[model samples]
Target: MDTLMPADDLTDELRAISAVVATLEHAQQNELPDEFAGLFRHDAIWTTGGGRRLLGRDAISAFTHQVLPGAMAASTATYEVEHVVFIRPDVVAVKVRQTPVGRDGVPLPGVNPGSPTYVMAKEDGRWLLVAAQNTEVVDG
Candidate 1:
């Protein structure tokens, strides 16, 4: 097994994770990615809001292209990074909230002002999300 890397090496990974989150938030709230090269691991997996399961980058990217624009068309996404923990030097877990907007600029249906848990891993100095699942907390 690979020895755990140092904490300092985690910065780049963290930055990459942040970039992915930012890009995803951007993609979710207003637009979609024309391609899915840098944002996700080639083998990434995601669980949709409606509980549909999608595996692999191509499937996820295709799902994004088909779904996001109509479901989340408003350009108003707010994000909050709740926690970042180092499970190992190459692995980190993040909790965050990505707010979405309605067509009238109001918060959208099924999108509460809350958070979700995301798991990201550093691979060859690049952080890519391996898994992302939702939090059960309701917007208060």
Candidate 2:
């Protein structure tokens, strides 16, 4: 079996991913669909906050351009990856927490801390999100 990557290398990779997340955050904040769409693959599928699924480059772009900006109107959405494990140099799985700010720039309720496992890959030296799914955390 192959051993895990070194801590330093993992840290660097995660940092690169963090930068990609930051870039997406900025594009969403600025309502830049073109820039946002540029971050993902043409055939990528995205799960929306409202429980809808978006597929294909055109659909994904349209969905974001139509819905996300309004849902997050005058708001900001930021995320932090809680954990990242590299399966290979090109593939990583990540657990992330998303926080959305209200129109007043205050954190909103029902933003209920959620977790999503993301599969990311480095394409042409840029980290891109390829696949992801939200994890439900139920407490009894």
Candidate 3:
């Protein structure tokens, strides 16, 4: 690590993380199950907003394939990285804000926003989603 902790390095890492989130948005927007599923680690754990638990990449892939297609035909979701906490040089906790919007670029009413946190780990020079928990933000 550079003595400065390299502001440039931090920026680069954030950029890469942002790119990953963008890829996730693209995959979901296009309903590409394979592309969406490929972002996770082999042993990744994911819990859906509806509270369904998915263990491992295979399970996640199956769920995506089953639900992703035709899921976006009605509306599209955009994910924004709201905050990132660096757990270590190679690990991070990412908070994403997900909103559903229509073709006209307006948010769909009655659809609660998503507050998901993705635990990402860098391995073999690549960042992968190691664990994720998706929670929908609903009004009390």
Candidate 4:
């Protein structure tokens, strides 16, 4: 079956989504777990790159607080929106590319980058991540 695209301004929507994704990266770079978790919905779901599932915002906060502070101790990660598909006027699926860089600002070796999918929903004129899955890009 063919999916019908919404009639909203695609460019504007893309820009808005990109900004949200950027904030996720910024939060990680700064090691601010609360800021990172705040981007999600109250009942958001997330799967980590290590395959652990987080059920809600509170769970996400707990996990992030335990891990995020030390995550970038050796290297920082950057996230960029690679694609955005609007499933509806209020829902979007976003593909993001994440790369970890060393203190010298060089891409780290032996550590593969990640590709994460974020499903976002627009509510009360704001976009919030409703669900997300982060996967490590393994090179064979």
Among all windows of ten consecutive residues in candidate 2, which has the lowest summed lDDT? 131-140
Q: Write the per-residue lDDT of candidate 2 for residues 1-140, one digit (tens) a residue.
A: 24277778767777899887777777877778877877777777778655677777678788778755555566676677787777888887777776667656577666565566677888888788787565443330
Q: Which of the numbered candidates is closest to the native, going by highest TM-score?
A: 3
For each candidate, give its TM-score against the true structure: 0.74, 0.79, 0.94, 0.90
Output the better candidate (1/2) by lDDT: 2
Extract clashing residue pairs from model 3.
none
Best lDDT goes to which candidate?
Answer: 3
Write the residue-wise lDDT of candidate 1 on 1-140 in tens digits: 23265556556556667786777676666566553324678898877656777787787888877776576544456566767887887778888876666556566677566466778887887678788765445644
**Clash tally, candidates in order:** 0, 0, 0, 0
- Deviation in Å, model 2, residue 6 alpha carbon: 4.4
Decreasing lDDT order of the candidates: 3, 4, 2, 1
Residues 1-42 of candidate 3 have per-residue lDDT tens digits of: 332347888898889989889999999898999999999999
* lDDT of candidates 1 onward, in order: 0.68, 0.72, 0.90, 0.88
Which runs in model 3 stand beyond 4 Å of their true positions? 1-4
Provide the global lDDT of candidate 2 against the true structure.
Answer: 0.72
